[model samples]
Target: MPSSVPSFAELLNQCERSAIHLELRDCYASTERFEAWKRGERIDWEDRESWWHPYDQLIAETVARGVSVRRARIVSEPVSEYIRWEHYVTHANVTAGEEVRWLPRRQATSISLPGNDFWLFDGALLRVHHFSGDGVVVEDEITADPETVKLCSAAFEAVWERALPHHLYTI
Candidate 1:
């Protein structure tokens, strides 16, 4: 992974057309949030006082500028509890104007996808994420390398073409 990159927020703010994310993991080891939810702390996304955050504000700002924000996740059919929690809370993302989708991992066997998750901004910059075995985010590499961007953009589109929209997806 490369260094000397701007913050994710800074890169997002620079986006002019689109921000597409490809999430290939079924579980993440950041267990704090998951444990809280597991303890039955319910979320009311409509209750902005409870679920809103600066990140939501950023997404709103980006979408307001007509820069489409989309996320596609490919998970195994019988997903992890974390993936189920993610599906439950996806309303927060949709509420902020970003589009979300889910694709079963079995459906992706034929596609050529990157090993790491990534965020492609405006089809120009690729923010590739590297995670440890336990799913901790170890590195975030930002690259303007045409090859990386092209590959990520193509992979995201391929997933998007087959993924089910959030509204239609079931845990």
Candidate 2:
């Protein structure tokens, strides 16, 4: 029989040692976890306010890791409904990196559901797959496949090429 599938955390651990790619859609768990890991904090799903803190950490960690993080959203709507004026304020307060790429709806190629918005991290790849009316599911894994990595890399680049620069107002 084929070897059993690896667990999500196990895959992440493996990815840390090799090349891995991930894609997240319509949700923020991957980002949240990335942040939590960076800050050495625990992720508390029960606390709503606690979530964004980790997301902020994730962004900083991604920058520090020197790995490329790419995001794409439907131009017709904001990338995240969770992102509000306060979110921007929080981002400004915590992050000091240059403007990262933001892909608008017009630029993004629409894919079907069961398809995810992606969060590609170099060290540990994390993907959050969202289903309408349902919730988000996560897949963390490692792979040595260059093609898979290239596909995600190209998709991010395509979106980035068409994305507008993000401008945030500092508090």
Q: Per-prediction RMSD in angstroms?
A: 1.8, 8.7
What's the lDDT for residue 152 in model 1?
A: 84
Worst 10 residues of 1 by lDDT: 1-10
TM-score for model 1? 0.95
Provide the overall lDDT of each model, using Cα atoms, as 2-decimal numbers.
0.90, 0.43
In model 1, the clashing pairs are none
In angstroms, give how far residue 128 of model 2 lies from its true place.
Answer: 5.7
* Residue 145 in candidate 1, Cα distance off native in Å: 1.7
Measured against the true structure, the TM-scores of the candidates, in listed sequence, are 0.95, 0.47
**Candidate 2, 35-59: lDDT as tens digits:** 5454666445446465555445544
Lowest summed lDDT window (length 10), candidate 2: 14-23
Stretches off by above 4 angstroms in model 2 are 1-52, 65-70, 77-99, 109-114, 123-132, 138-144, 168-171
Candidate 2, residue 51: the lDDT equals: 52
